[model samples]
Target: MDFSSKLLENAVYEMSQLPGIGKRTALRLVLHLLKQPEERTNLLSEALTDLRAKVNFCKSCHNISDTEICEICSNHKRDKSLVCVVEDIRDVMAIESTSQYNGLYHVLGGKISPMEGIGPQDLSIVSLVNRVKEGEVKELIFALSSTMEGDTTNFYIYKQLEGLDVTTSTIARGIAVGDELEYADEVTLGRSILNRIPFENSIKAS
Candidate 1:
């Protein structure tokens, strides 16, 4: 698209570089910012600058944080022996929203994607093994997504932890309750069947 100013074009280009953002959306954002007071844009820019300048990764879990250790890792009430391994901080947020897990987390930073040139060495896998070797950890909950890369990463980590005294498990994949089975994908429907509980156990909550 043509722009009256090179500066506007540059801003649109930079914004469009963000994931899921297209050129049209980026141009709309740029135009919207231009319509606002200069102070508003300055605040937005300053916040981004401060974030990029000061954001830190949690030393223990590798999640994004403002401190060396994130709040989750520092919490005393969380079960340190039961660690949930996830792909990224976004997964941590998604799990935390459920408030069902009270265990600590080990963020892998990213999954093993051969096509993308990301492998076990590219992630924080060694630190996780070290954490398990400390002898306090008893179980590991694999909470990574059910994608091919996610599975490859989980299997790699599992192999690394072999004979290491920790019990490893994957988060169950299945269809959501109340959803129509006809709409469910074949894999999910098949998994739900394979992982089904006994009728008596399923009614325990009632």
Candidate 2:
């Protein structure tokens, strides 16, 4: 695509770098922003800058936060003993929307995908194991997507917690195989969480 202005070209290029956004879509977005008031564009730029500069990850669960700990982790009413394991903040938001779980969460950052060069060490598995070993978490709910990498990550974590007192479970197959939790409907995700089964049973079925 040719551009008359380098500023517009740069804006579209940056916008296109976001996932699922193409150059055409990015160009449209940049044009729209250009049409908006200067103050509105400044606000958008400021928000993005602040997000990148000031955002923090929850010390406990690693969810994006403004403080050291996220509101969910700091909430006293949440079930600290029941920790839901997920890929990232998006999955956390998806599960939270269901309102079916009162448990805390542990964001693994990502699943173990050899094709993507993402291994067990690339995630927060060690911190999770430490949380289990500390004896505060009584049960772990594997809430990763229903993909091979998700299953592999779950199994790896399960093995790490071997002989530990904590119980392990995985969301039910209500979520289709290879489906991401973030894309599932709230009702289905809620039911899956409510009907989670033992990790050992899932392993056997696989």
Candidate 3:
């Protein structure tokens, strides 16, 4: 696309770099931002800048946070012994919306996708194993999506926790095959969490 102003072009280009945003959508967004008051645009820019510079990952679960630990991890009422394993903060948010689980969470960062060059080491699996070894976590709920990579990551972590006292479970198939947890309806997701089965049973069924 051609632009009369290079500033507009630059803004659209940067905005288009976001996932699911095309050049056309980015251009429209840039134009909308340009139409807004200068203070509003400045606020947007300042918010993005602050998000990138000031955000911290929770030391315990690796969820994005403003402090060293996320509110969920620090919440005394949450079940610390029941840790839900998820891909990232989005999934954490998805599960939290269900309000069916009172457990803590462990964000793996991503699944083990060989096609994408993401492996066990690329995720926060080691820290998870350490958490399990520390004997605080009594059960691990594998809440990753039902994709092959997700299953692989879950099994890899399951093996790492082999012979350990912690029990392992996976969310029920209320979520369709290959579906992401973030996309599932709150009711279905809640039911899945409530009806989670043993990791070994999931392996046998697979």
Candidate 4:
């Protein structure tokens, strides 16, 4: 390939590596980007380059933030005594879209998957425990998936907070089994949160 062709090929390859994008889609995107004004293309490239430079995970909740703490964490209107535990930031976005929850969130960063070599220690469970140990938390709602890893993580967290004063609960069955919390619709997720059940009682009643 010539110089210009080589640049196109590189762009296509990089775009194809993104999730849910294949070669054809990547080629289409590259062609679209190429059609934009030179300044617009430059801005796009600079934004992509600055993504890592500008964004960082909030230390308190582990959500993506531009500053030390995310806006949610800094908001005084949010309920500080209640926390919703989720697997990742995408799940946070899903729940936020619902506009029904008023509590803070704790992002686990990942679920506990022994088969994939991810354990409780690999997540932000310890940080969550520390947050609870502060004695300000009154409730912990587990919004993890209903998958094996999700269940394992939920149980692990329950065990960790066994002697705490706070109540532990999990989202209701509004979401289908084996589905990710991030993929659940806003209405379904909101309903699940509103109808959450105590984790301990849920297991015993099962």
Candidate 5:
């Protein structure tokens, strides 16, 4: 972890701050950048700056978008009445890659995790409930990860839609109990979606 220069040290520290990256890797990256042309580094910096400044969340589904609403939410071909509730945009992308789901999505941004200090209020649960309450939505599919936090979040949302006339379900447990949807292969994830079980059944089994 020794650095010859303060500038290199600071660069390594910043790069190492990224998840899963260590000091040695960060130094290698810094050296790689140093070897590259200045234009390459400038281009990388400019791209990151532009992404931060220009990206916005969709007003309807809260997914990443350039406009007020995401393309999925605005698409007329998607079934508006069937909603797949997920942890984040990554889950949305995973589900969409299947090409089996023709429904809309509700990205929760994150799940309820007490250890991490994440609560229902911290996510987009209210927007999801409102989407169901506004009354075109007939089905609510819980497509969150199978972890404890994911289950807790799903249960919370299921309870929120209790008095409403919507049918609720969760993707089948084809993936392992603690696996994330984003990590699952398309075939398994797609089959799970197609064979989703009732939310009540899922809750009862747990």
Candidate 6:
């Protein structure tokens, strides 16, 4: 019969629950944490404990924030007429890092994945539609991932915004197919944004 303490077993189990972490990695982490000073372990515990307590979603954009509205949404320097709709907060960080865009952001929180049981209702789509309906935005940029799920989500958003005065478009297809915006480099992402194409507009033989 195994005699491992329940606390240690619980720690390993919780760590293993994180994506990409397995039993072996969790055990290694637990062992490493055990070797750390009490202060280190305490710090980790306190940070995790305070994560949900300190972080709040921005009411306007659904981005993680400490205040009611995220700094990006509140900033007057940002271009209020343009809203970049992305899959998550990570994409916001990626775009911000480029220092090329001056527009506001709307984090959808996730893509529409029917198989995964995630749909527009599961995301911040309603808030996004409401924000656009306010009529301040002149352009809507779809900065979602290039995957099938991302495409599905973008199309859903497009249909929702149909007939709005706002012009809709997406970042150029320069980004590799299936490559997530967060994992893409700054130059590629910046160029992709700079070279965005208009939605429903086509260049045909004159």
Winning candidate number (TM-score): 1
The CA lDDT at 68 in model 1 is 94
Colliding pairs, model 5: none
Residue-level lDDT of model 5, residues 64-159, one tens digit each, is 999899899999999999999998888998998978799999998889999999988999999899998899999999998878888899899988
Candidate 2 C-alpha lDDT tens digits along 1-206: 98999988898999999999999999999888878889998998899999999989999999999889899999999999999999999999999998889999999999999999998889999999998999999999999987788889999999999999999988766788789989999978897898888999879876
Model 3 score (lDDT): 0.91
User: Which residue pairs does candidate 6 place in steric collision?
Assistant: none
Error of 5 at 120 (Å): 0.7
Q: So what's the TM-score on candidate 6?
A: 0.82
Off by over 4 Å in 2: 175-206
Reference-based TM-score, model 5: 0.83
lDDT of 1 at 69: 96
TM-score of each candidate?
Answer: 0.94, 0.83, 0.83, 0.80, 0.83, 0.82
Q: Is candidate 1 or candidate 6 better by lDDT?
A: 1
* Model 1 segments more than 4 A misplaced: 200-206
CA lDDT of every candidate = 0.92, 0.92, 0.91, 0.91, 0.90, 0.89
Q: Could you give the C-alpha RMSD of every candidate to the true structure, in order shown?
A: 1.5, 7.2, 7.1, 7.3, 7.2, 7.2
Q: Given candidate 1, what's the lDDT at residue 87? A: 89
Write model 1 residue lDDT over 1-206, tens digit each, in one string: 88899999999999999999999999999999999999999999999999999999999888888889999999999988999999888999999998989999999989999899997889999999999999999999999889999888989999999889999999878887689988999999998899987889769844
lDDT tens readout by residue for model 3, 79-165: 999999999999999999988899999999999999999988899999999999999999999999877888889899998998899
Candidate 4 or 3, higher lDDT? 3
Q: Quick one: RMSD of model 3?
A: 7.1
lDDT per residue as tens, model 6, 33-133: 99989899999989988996787999999888989989999999999999999999899999999888999999998999989999789999999999999
Candidate 3 runs further than 4 Å off: 175-206
